[model samples]
Target: GAGVSQSPRYKVAKRGQDVALRCDPISGHVSLFWYQQALGQGPEFLTYFQNEAQLDKSGLPSDRFFAERPEGSVSTLKIQRTQQEDSAVYLCASSLALGGEMAGYTFGSGTRLTVV
Candidate 1:
């Protein structure tokens, strides 16, 4: 794809339901990231992966949230037992550089998840 592509642009989940959001990054991009954005708030880092190795996931809100990039191309973020507080826009981004290297991130149109 020419740019980052995310699936299910909008999602509505009932409380306690699980949801998986997918992100297909640009070809050859080595860094993939996931973020959570609350209503009217800036995106907050959720996790980061370098290639197929997850480098940082300290920002994830809880154990209910998990992110992975198995082949270094496509990534999925799964949320289990979704809560009302979990309703937010999930953003995915990718870059060509490694950690500490300055590179512009290409972001996808986030998947907005609403829990009710």
Candidate 2:
């Protein structure tokens, strides 16, 4: 894919159900980031991975949320026991390298998750 790709563009989860979102970044990209965007708010960084190694996860809101990129290509974000407060869009972004080109990041269309 030419740009970052996310699956299930929209999802409606029943309260307490677990959900998994997928992100497929551009091929060979070294840096991948996951962010959460509440309605009408800017995206907030959730975690960062550089080539299969998770370098930062400080932005993850709670233990119930987990993200991983085991092969440095595809990543998955899993949220457990979905709650109404958790409803938001999950964004995935990728860059060619760490702090490369200064063009910032290429963000995917994002997966909008709704909890009811």
Candidate 3:
């Protein structure tokens, strides 16, 4: 893909349901990141993967949130037992550099998950 692509641009999940969001990053991108963005706020880092290794997951809000990039190209973020407070826009980004900040990032439009 020419840019980062996210699936199910909008998602509605019932409370307690599990949801999985997918991201297809640009070819050859080595750094993949997941972020949670609440309404009226900037995106908050959730996790980061260098290649296929998950190097940083401390930013994830809770154990219910998990992210992985098994093949180093596509990634998935899964949320279990969704809650009202969990409703937010999930953003996926990819960068050519190991430290994403240095190379900037290409972000997907994001998946808007609304819990009800």
lDDT top scorer: 1
lDDT by residue (1-116, candidate 1, tens digit) is: 89999989999999999999999999999999999999999999999999999999999999999998989899999999999999999999999886536768999999999999
Show the lowest summed lDDT stretch of 10 residues, model 2.
Answer: 97-106
**Per-residue alpha-carbon lDDT of model 2 for 1-116, expressed as tens digits?**
88899998999999999999999998878899999999889999899999999999999999999998999899999999998999999999999867757667889999999999
> Cα RMSD to native, each candidate?
1.3, 1.0, 1.1
lDDT of 2: 0.93
Models sorted by TM-score, best on top:
2, 3, 1
Q: In terms of lDDT, which candidate is stronger, 1 or 3?
A: 1
Candidate 3's TM-score reads 0.96
> 14-102 in candidate 3: lDDT tens per residue?
99999999999999999899999999999999999988999999999999998888888899999999999999999999999866667
Considering summed lDDT, which 10 consecutive residues are worst modelled in model 3?
97-106
